[model samples]
Target chain A: MNSRLQAWLLALPATFFVVVCLGLPVLSTLATTFGEPAGPFVTYIQFFTSGFRRAVLLRTIEVAVITTAISLVVGFATAWVVARSPGRIKSILIIAAVFPLLTSVVVRSFAWMVILGKNGIINKALLALGILNEPLSMLYTEGSVIVAMVYLFVPLMILTLVGVLEGIPQDLTDAAASLGAPPSAAFRQVVLPMAVPGLIVGAVLVFTGSFTSYATPQLLGGDRQTMMGTFLYQRAMVTFDWVGASTIAAVMVVVTIATVLLMSRLARKLNPVVG
Target chain B: MKTRIHPALIAFSVFTFVFLIGPLIIIIGTAVSDTTFLTFPPQGFSMRWFANIFEVSAFPRTMVTSFTLAVLATTLSLMVGVPAAYALARFRIELPKFLANVFVLPILVPEIVLGFSLLKSVATGVGASIWTSLLIGHALLVLPYCVRVVGASLNSFDFSVEEAAVSLGCPRWKAFFVVVLPNIRAGVIAAFILAFITSINDVSVSIFLTGPGISTLPIQLLAHMEQFFDPTIAAVSVLLMGVTVAVMTVVEWTLGLTFLTK
Candidate 1:
């Protein structure tokens, strides 16, 4: 086959899979926004006008922002530790880092519910200490959702960082230290620049995971906090406003694709291999 | 050449261990609560709720549903994804490298969007069925990870060995089967295990694709969680956690832990 034909032929099966599964609805779901003309745009108008959807979107953004920041901080510490640790401990820590990710998301969310719910472990401990007169309502709030997401996703960030960090030669850091650069200074100047691309993509991953996640918000958040995913689900499945649901799905799909593409471009500039 | 780890990093890693494993500890604790109602630090211990999972027919059926779907979908994804990945990686095609990226982007899209999209397409293309729709949907969900694992392996590969075999007067198919297949084994295994774990644990997609009579483990947990707050959920979670640990251990053993780092 001609190389171009070869390329297309090589890519065709996977492309077909993506086209049928991902590309199709991403295009079709937008039409769901227009609603049946014979019917009304009332669902679209209602969904947009509702302060509830606005609040949910805002909260989702807020949660995503917080998740990115916290996971970055904790993930950095974990990655740094794993990078510098002895081989045996490093392997053990790596296993620990990956365990949460391998488990079912639903299982982990329920694990959080047990940890955070009223009359759950944290509350009982607090009550025993007389710190609180009654068990606190910790579950079904914005906090639980973010915590679960961070716990679920931080390992991903750490993994990427470890890979990038390992690629950077240790000699550079040693040379910096030999020149009297402080340990902290060595990291700030020598390590961070090389690690920037990995960290940025990692940030995007954590951010997007939090933003689009449906189950985490539904199981963990209070009813008052409806994220876009939960919001889309309520519209399509619960309220049966197929169009409104489809509109939100379309917007979400576009946003997700655009964000990743934008990041990949920036990543390519940072590390040419990513392109 | 000396390579020594800093002790400060050890202290920091101790904290990492706590945050990662703490929730599992708390969940298992609550499962044995002696109270008539759920209690945090159980006044006493019992296996009542663990037994309760069996009493509730939903739990057993959900487990069966999750395993069946995971096995079927992972198998379908492997059959499709392996060849596509082979073609992309081994062949020196003139396509833009971005075609490779396009193959893997499905991993990043949220489950909710995927669920709705799959539902719409399946309904439109062929009336949604319990098996076919779920199979295709889960295959889509697992496809990207499989391709990435296999594709990365292919990119850094040595093609000369395969050519060496072809030049030895072996048939073309024999050259590919004998020379190329064995080399990319780790990546293929990684892809399969990832597909299996992901397909098994998925909730967002299953909730949409599943019918009234069909329910998966995550959805099973979701329904139980919605109506009641109890330790049974935790018992089930611990059970699930055991499976998670085992699968990950197997994957790490079979495919080196850093297999994807390449």
Candidate 2:
């Protein structure tokens, strides 16, 4: 066979699979929204105008933003400290940091239920302290949802930031310190600025992860809260409204693409050198 | 240059590590608890729950189904992904960037969207069976990883080795099978293991794709949680966590965990 034909033959199976499995389904779902009672643009109109969906959309974005912000700050500090630790300690610390990401999200969510439930660890500790007359209601709340999400995704942020932190030279920080800057100033002026690309990448990942996550909020948020993910599940599975589900799914894709574009553009403006 | 360790940084790191690991620790503790109701810091200790998993018929059935799905998905993904990676690595083919991005679109797209979309298509008869739907969904999700890991390995390999084999009168296909394949064995193996683990632990896409009378382990566990809150799920979760740690340890020992971290 000729070289071009050989490459095509080699590529055929994956191409076929992607088209059949991914491309067609995604396109068809997006196409389905254009049909049915509400029709294409009308469904988008109704969805945005409706109070319940609008709140779910806003709440999803709000949770994602908070989760990403907390994950980034905590991740940056953890990554910095892990990067600075000595040999064996550093290796162990890195292993410990990433240990959570290896396990299933289902497992992680289940564990969080035990810790945050009414008679769970945190409430038990508080009751023991005599800080409250009764067990504080911690589980099935919006705060628990955020806590679960932040806990689930912070390790990812740390892993991303660690890679960036490792890339920076020690001499730059030392140079800043020698110029009468304290450790904090050196970190803020030299290290933080250099890690912008990592921050941008990590931020997009954590935000997208939190936004699309179904299990964390489902188990922790209880009946009172409904994020976009659970909302999508309910629309498609519970209500059997394929059109509404497809529209929501499409909106998620658009929002994710928008966030990535916005973040990358912002990163480019902040530091033209990296890209 | 001398560097000083900040006490505050150490404290913060310690606290973060605890937060990350504290939940899993609680699950393990709950597994061995003597009392029920998902209590932590157990009233006493027992292995009864671990043995109790066998009494639950759905648990074992779901375990078998999940393992079978993961294995099949891994095999199919590798079959599709390996040659695709080879083509991408070897030739400056047409729409090269586009092809690369197409393989990667699965990662960029929200998985919940993917699941919902696939659910609609399957219901409308895009796929012939629920088994096929779940398999296709899983294989697509793990497809990017297979291409990525194998492609990275291919990039680091010397193309001239295969060229030398072809020049020495070896047929093109034989050159790939006998000469090139052996060299990239580590990458192929790593890709397979990674794909298998991903398929096994996956819940998001499988949640929508699962059908009547067939459920993956995660889905079964989720369904179980909806009705009953007990140590049985914790015991199962602890076992699953053990399996994950074992698989990841193998990956780390063999490939340095960079495939995951990167």
Best by DockQ: 2
Root-mean-square deviation per candidate: 2.9, 1.7
Could you give me the TM-score of model 2 versus the true structure? 0.96
What digit string (tens of lDDT, one per residue) describes model 1 on residues B1-262? Answer: 3655567666765776797787777777777877556665666989998999899899999899888888888887777777777777666446667777676767766778888777776754468686777888788889988887877777767988887887889886787678787888777787877888898888877777777888788888888888877778878888888888778777787676765343
DockQ of each: 0.60, 0.70
True contacts kept of each: 0.63, 0.67
Residue pair clashes in candidate 2:
none
Residue pairs with backbone atoms closer than 3 Å in model 1 (clashes): A32-A243, A140-A222
> lDDT of each structure?
0.78, 0.87
Proportion of true inter-chain contacts also present in candidate 1:
0.63
Error of 1 at B168 (Å): 3.6
Compose the digit string of candidate 2's lDDT tens values, residues A3-104: 888888888899988887788888888887778664559889988999999999999999999999999999998998877777688777777766788788
Candidate 1: lDDT of B59? 94
Task: Tell me how many residue pairs clash in candidate 1.
Answer: 2
Q: Per-candidate TM vs. native?
A: 0.92, 0.96
